[model samples]
Target chain A: MAEILTAKKLAIKVSICLAVLVAVMALCAMVGTQKISLKKVFAGPGQEPGQNIDYEILVGVRLPRVILAALVGAALACSGVVLQAILRNPLADPYILGISSGAGLGVITAVISGITWKFWGGSPIAVFAFVGALATVWLVWCIGHLTGKSQVTSLLLAGVVINAFFSAVIMFLISIAKSEQLRSTVLWLMGNIIEKDPAVLGVSTVCILAGIIALFSISHRLNILTFGQEEAKGLGVDTAKTTAIAFGLAAFTTAIAVSLSGLIGFVGLIVPHGVRLVFGPDHRQLLPVSAIIGGAFLVVADTLARIIVAPAQLPVGVITAIAGGPFFLVLLAKYSRKVSWLK
Target chain B: MSGIIEVKDLNFGYTPQSTILKALSFEVIQGRFVGIAGPNGAGKTTLLNLLCGLLRSKAGSIKIDSVPIESYSARKLAKKVAVVRQEFVPVFDFCVAEVVSMARTPYLSTFGFESDTDKKIIDEALEMTDTARFASRPLANLSGGERQRVFIARALAQNTDILLLDEPTTFLDLKHQVGIYDLLKRMQLEKGKTIVVVTHDINLSTQYCDEILLLGADSSYQYGSAKDVFSPHKIEKVFGVRGFAGKIGTEKFFLPLGKFAKDAHIITTNINSTTKK
Candidate 1:
């Protein structure tokens, strides 16, 4: 709800969220199997870089993993927010657009076919996943456009059909895969955040940040869009243009997240919704706060995944589902009675 | 010829096989209140959509302020005309003021935030619609009529010269229905807006509108002042209901005599008690 929205209030809110994220990230970064002293991370006077075990584990290992999780989390969450608005459906999430399934198929193809391709620090799987996601989005867009019907409904139908088809293909590939290939395929499908490539991490950070900025710029248009396509048009929004752009950007960001960290679940669905409840439905407040909080949430989940099994790390996606499923149920039970806003 | 909204022989349909509006032509003069009434599937909403360019009139022309509707971009047309929907169930809990503030979309760019002047306009809209009291409350917390008023406020905030509404009084209680019409009348008399509403309440439309457009199921219509167009014969012909036409004060009203209206002395054309001095 609106409260005489001012730039100052939004700035203050985002700053508080950013501070919380920093605290959460710091706490999670220190929670791995090896206890890391902050002194080793920064290195006092005579200590050589990466010389200490604590330094190597904290700065070298935990830091990159934490950053990747944060990036993917933010990407998925903000994309979820945009998709929810554009689709005007509460159940809509980043994966509802079929980008994740598309990426999953790509990962399977790369794993089973054993054809490696690399570009700018991207592994074959990541590259394949990115391509698959984008291609699926393009196909969906084409189908939606070709139908020339209700944009939202067409997109949803296309996405669901494509996702179902791809999931079937993925299952088929998994059934016949060699043992090692099957292991890799299952691992990617479950989602992981283990990128040692600095270029990939840095590039992903820049892309995710840019995507979030783009979404923020369209936040006002998005607010109107949530009120159905015709109503948005009644308010003078170019519903077609806004939906296409928001859908594309959300898909792009989701694709990036999926490529970098396999098929992580629920952060997008849970984070935006929770943030909306607390911050109200204003996207100007919702987008940035959800991104920061979403990032922090996954970092914590990833941390728990790492420490729960000690040296044997669980895929971060497994942790998210194990955590997210119960949290989502709780949210439904508590808020189902209160959601009187819609018919 | 001085028409703010001029639709000439408009024809439309969701599909080519199922045409809804057929060769419809009418003009709403600027600064007047007009009502469009028809039975279900009579293309009343289609007409409104055509006027707003939400639906293209494949075989005809709709002009706003003497310019073709297609000549202006959506944003540009929205500056001259605003639309108020029956209800807004946006699936999110937007506050009254926030929902109203959304009317400022055409005025603001993608990169532009609402300025103080825009805020003042929103406040004024809320004030005009009498929704200012609950401006901070979640829209879901409000009653149906209150929610309708909030949408009216949103349209008012658009500050357009023309306001078009589709079944604006649907599902509202009698009081809120009258309240919405009163507000619309005020919008015409005070703000100098050209008003058009599609409504099922033919009696209320006759009371408030300067002119009435009675649409028939067979692509025919009657456009005249309420006294000229809203007769017992036309009402019965168009709506398939027996109508008793009478006057209360200066405004004409209709009474629909149903098949099972109940054998009560309550059914009266007794204009004496109901008529006001």
Candidate 2:
């Protein structure tokens, strides 16, 4: 009887996730200029020349944007789930440990120097962003290790300090940037899903997917981690090793996401919490559900960003922050009611 | 069913120079309900941490079933011994059943899903600890006593032969304290589980334990039957309390005593006379 209930619950959760994904996909296709009909959108991009008004737009623009949104969203959300579990802090987001700040700093540096193109004009921004993110994670870990206090509190404090430092550096770079360079940098920092090469999107999608898969594979261990470090060890987890792997995966996913879409915040913080409220904090359920919800959330947010200003196209990051900031404040207010030792 | 744990010349400390346990040695035979009693900073928790491999011992060895603990892999050690810590701050809001099921992690594959056998063990543990009723309730919502029982259920689900509890009754009320002790005693008798409980409640130790280990300062330890080790002299020497041992309804208890002033007798007599008049 209980097994039946468990099966039913699982099915309902999966069905809801699939339904959300489909709904978001539809919204993404329908929202942009030259709206495509659902029938034509799914009918395999009309083959007849010139009769395919919707085909070019669907295949050329909307599809890549939607796919990018899903990939970046999933990456951020999955990173958030792992960080929250490891740090045992519900307030922890993907950027809690300065990954986003580092990525931002790297991009600002690239823009201020008029180095828009990669070395030899190839993927410079993404490469710098990834490297910077990695460096930031490494620095935070080193400081945590040096303190000889590997507790979550110490790691969090280290991240906060590093984030502050990186934020200041980014501001400095912005101040020195030329007008055109500054405008471009501002657009990048505001974060958009515009003009991404399909190949770069595909590569980033694979990276983010791989990181999410690795994280989900350890869902059970993550469940144990929610019990805090000592109990996790007592339950036979190699706490130190598991902690490192979790943080590494989180950094990897966050770096790739930030590389793809410059510094999109709050999707990571919002989606996982939303999933947890529904799914009850079981990472086995929470990770997958958060991924789907996160993907859908970003797609819808991007759709709104495109439509809200009409033709001028506000940055997707601006839309998400506008949507998410109040929600985050509400959550903070709710969680602050009772001061929990674990948080 | 012969199971024995021996700690030989164990040395441990949080810092480099300040050793908490120095050359501390003892042996607990299988199925014994051993209570560890001591005053504050007596290294009771440190000793338990060493036993469970949470803290590495600087010197000596711990052996279970005549095999050295250091020789066993962490997973293997988890299968043999389970530690129930005094305070647990759960970061997520997991159901009681899910929390208890985590004990099967060591026995699980890399994926860590619970098998049918694992489910059976978890169910049995929940039943044993009487937490089955609230299995679906979030652990955060439960009362302190309930949470403690849930943790015990988790330890029980580990299916280990040795169970170490670090001050399990620290925050519990009197009823819950006695209740947990009774549960441990029952498990020891029925399952023949080796139970080592570190507690500041010497009275409970005297009433429930098969044996007691009194930890003193300067790396000294006294171990024997509860009666033999819980004497007033030993209590005073270790706890800096002038106390007397007394019996009330087949249970021994210790009460603090103090020297009398020269006018104490006269004052007592005057009070008695006044009451009589």
Candidate 3:
């Protein structure tokens, strides 16, 4: 009887919080830099008496940017949850695993070498980033598996080494790049989601949605995996296949997010940890709640980023780093004893 | 197909030459509580892993109910066998109920929500293990013995016919150790669970287990009824210690005299003198 009540209460809480988030997002959409009235926002395409200007700024500029922030935030948080569960470490994130560096390298390669391709109206940068992320994940898995068993310590050390090496290579590429390419690369590496292209937004939306759905589908297997690989296998999880699917989808979502915006850090690491602290570690609830909260959190952060400087926006990544750095330190201190990878 | 296991001439090693368990064979009847006992590095845990197909044998075979262990998928095999490991500390804060509910993973859908049936089983498991009171508490807050029982509750929720435990009493206190053995014994008799436990407590095995397999040096094992296998000669020879087996009110125990004596004559005289009593 008590169990049922707690579960019901949690469900009610989540629903209420989601509704509140929707309202917050709506208010934020209205209050950014210029306060456009609902009339102008809904006025459609018109050239009469400031109609086109308000509509373009509200619908074309602000709405898409907000939507893109929500999508990328949800993607990063979901990726964090999956990586942390699989690696059995609280500190495992796309950025920590060298995945973001790998994706950044791919984007730089595309930018400097003038190698471009378009897929389903998404930029060539996203494709290169996705390929790079997947390749790095595969390489890390291989290195971690050299002993025939993928120990958590080995996987973490391999990630650390790969992250360092990939970052150096990215720096080398940045040094030789043209001035325009360098600025673009720098902006991307610092993380910003100013892309106003509807086609790219549409592609990213579909991919992030599909990736979250796929992640939610495997959340059960991920719950078992948190007990570690051997126990998960004993409980009947196909550890190898589940790991592959999870890494693949997480990398795909992260690649899209990284390419859409520059390498945003900490949203993935912080959101899931915050969610776990509040909701406990049942992945069924963890994945979805984290996704929702992550989206809302980023919407708020990006809003702050825009308004903080008044016409000169600070990158959202800067805000997350400032906030999440101390939180990461606290978590490291708390969990270092239990998690060997922390050492 | 309820808990009958057959292992034949299994061989395993991390490397080619350094074999752990070689040419091993054993058969377990239905509904028996068996204990695997040995000194350190006897490959008892390795054998348990092989039984559940967590570790593949380099040679020979293991069959559960006349089917090869490899024939069943990991998920399918989990429906028949559940294992409680010695060491598992979750990195995140999973409450006791949530950890126990993870046993329903094989039965859950892609989204992994627990159904009504899964909930009932989880409740029953928690109640049986006496972990229902701490259902809302984070597992990290529990004491070692309480956490151990919670793990047992998880394995119970798995609802497999065969339950395997690897050193379930490692970090537990004396009372908790006996409590766990008593719980397993009750399940063996009342619930008819086929249990295989790897324990270093030879006395605990002798008091409760229906049969005990004593692993010896050179990848060998001696298997029989507890009464047949717990003799002083076999204990001393296998464990490399001087021990005398004695019974008080039909409950047998082995008391180690000391490490084997350096003088062969003194060892022989001592063994001969103790056996005469």
Q: Evaluated with TM-score, which candidate comes out highest?
A: 1
Off by over 4 Å in 2: A1-12, A38-51, A116-123, A326-343, B1-3, B257-277
lDDT, candidate 1, at B136: 88
- Residue-wise lDDT of candidate 3 within A88-202, one digit each (tens)? 8887886767788788888899889886666665557777877887788778878887854566778788888998999999999988999999987787788887855787788
The better candidate by TM-score, 1 or 2, is: 1
> Which docking band does candidate 2 fall into?
acceptable
**TM-scores for every candidate against the unseen true structure:** 0.93, 0.92, 0.92
Clashes of 3: 0
Kindly report the docking quality category of candidate 1: medium
lDDT of 2 at A315: 90
Please list the C-alpha lDDT of all candidates, in the order they appear.
0.84, 0.82, 0.82
RMSD for all candidates, in order, please.
3.3, 4.5, 3.3
Residue lDDT tens for model 3, B79-198: 899999985567777778888888888887666567788889999999988999999877777888899899999999998989999999988889999999988888788778899999
What is the per-residue lDDT of model 1 for residues A1-343, given as tens digits with 9 covering 90 to 100? Answer: 2356667888899999999988888788888767778876677433565467787777677888888888899999999999999988888989997898889888888888888666674558888999999998888888877775677888889989999999998889889989988988888888888855887788889999999999999998899899988888887788888888898899999999998888998999989988877677888888989999899989999988888988898999999989988877776666654455433
Question: Rank by DockQ, descending?
Answer: 3, 1, 2
Count of backbone clashes, every candidate in sequence: 0, 0, 0
